[model samples]
Target: MLGARAWLGRVLLLPRAGEETRMAQSPAPIPCQPTTCSSSMGHKDWMDKCVCLLTAFSEHMRRVPVALPEMVHAFSAQQQTLKQIVICGDRQAKDTKALVRCVHSVYIPNKVLILADGDPLSFLSCQLPFLSTLRRLEDQATAYVCENQACSMPITDPCELRKLLHP
Candidate 1:
């Protein structure tokens, strides 16, 4: 009985060569330049694309277990020559872990902005008690734009998000 149990354990513990190889290998993603806006495009068209791209990226990051690695692999595969990539956020400091994950995955080439949402003044004054702490945490990045916990710059002008992405 003991011999049989030992045999069973060995069989269960054995790693298939093919499975091991596959597990060791990572998937490559379609890479693009770091943060170059797709040029020769109109503002309306650009905005549309930007929204779509951002939405897709956000969704993927939210869902995938190893989202950062996949994003990095994709970016590297594309050899994306980026000047910078801005990440617009609500600036709760709650998402700092996710931000750190992003930092680990991508090599910060130029700048990465973690922008806040909504109106900056109220969020800074009323809600965020550790505003200075939040800013300091973001000091690790290229810049941290605050606007009501939303992005103050990139999408500030309403259409800039769209324009920057497409046009």
Candidate 2:
């Protein structure tokens, strides 16, 4: 990542051939168009902010930018419940990635994915305590769709998970 950052003012990805990627003149922090955290906050703080923004933007449908940013805070507290999907399996396995891809395809904005690969990182369960109890059902990749921390039955089929998320 640092290697990429080193080339900051030197290169940019253009949408079309021979197009100008940036302005001739700009303020400090020359390349601010795309940034992870442009403030004094450290990496973890920036990551948490990114996750929060992702959660907020996921709520808007095909379009919402036409409205003011205030729409995000306008929602009632009760309606802001987060939906967590915990996947317990070998995260490196091809099948596990496929399941995660399917989850990413869903339009539901409040959803978040947590991968709990078991023992070596069992301490992870301390952060998300439910991971301590949930395991691979039937010895296969399993997904638990939980809302407000209460989950529906363990899901082993991608289609079943889709139905639960969308319909």
Candidate 3:
């Protein structure tokens, strides 16, 4: 069996309908750059594609077991304080993804995101009192930024959400 990265290289080189003929005529490159798949490509059977990908990955993992890699970030924060962002709203709301991305960009160290549908805060807040007030503002997707149980006012706009995470 090939190593995970090499196997992935070959799998990625699989040609699409139109490219099949051209790809077969020439050899694939020795090195392949990683690529991201967009959901907008109009492939209707994404779930099936996901299943196939997962199955292949699982088979590879069963044989190799584990792969260790060390990563270093020079600009990473040295602080230990946890910055938690709690978002409560419709999970499928388009803006929800943007809100999550905003949280990721600002905090590099010790960050946690708690995503919930509606207000499940009554029970959860008992343990983390800071989240007691987390809820969707105006029935729209809302974000709350908290540190050490102290939280900011609900943010309804993407720009406002990013500012809260940065400041």
Give lDDT: candidate 3, residue 40.
Answer: 16
Q: Count the backbone clashes (under 3 Å) in each candidate.
A: 18, 0, 0
lDDT of 2 by residue, 1-59 (tens): 12212233323412223212211121111122112221211234433443454455454
Alpha carbon lDDT of residue 70, candidate 3? 6
In candidate 1 the C-alpha lDDT for residue 54 amounts to 40
Ranking by TM-score: 2, 3, 1
lDDT of 2: 0.55
lDDT per residue (tens digit) for residues 96-135 in model 3: 8778777777744546687766454455555454455577
The residue-by-residue lDDT of candidate 1 on 21-103, one tens digit each, is 32233221211221122211112343344344444665555555343553554344334333323333445544434543444
lDDT agreement of model 1 with the native: 0.35
Error of 1 at 18 (Å): 14
lDDT: worst 10-residue window of model 1:
1-10
So what's the TM-score on candidate 1? 0.22
TM-scores for all candidates: the values are 0.22, 0.54, 0.46
* Strongest candidate by TM-score: 2
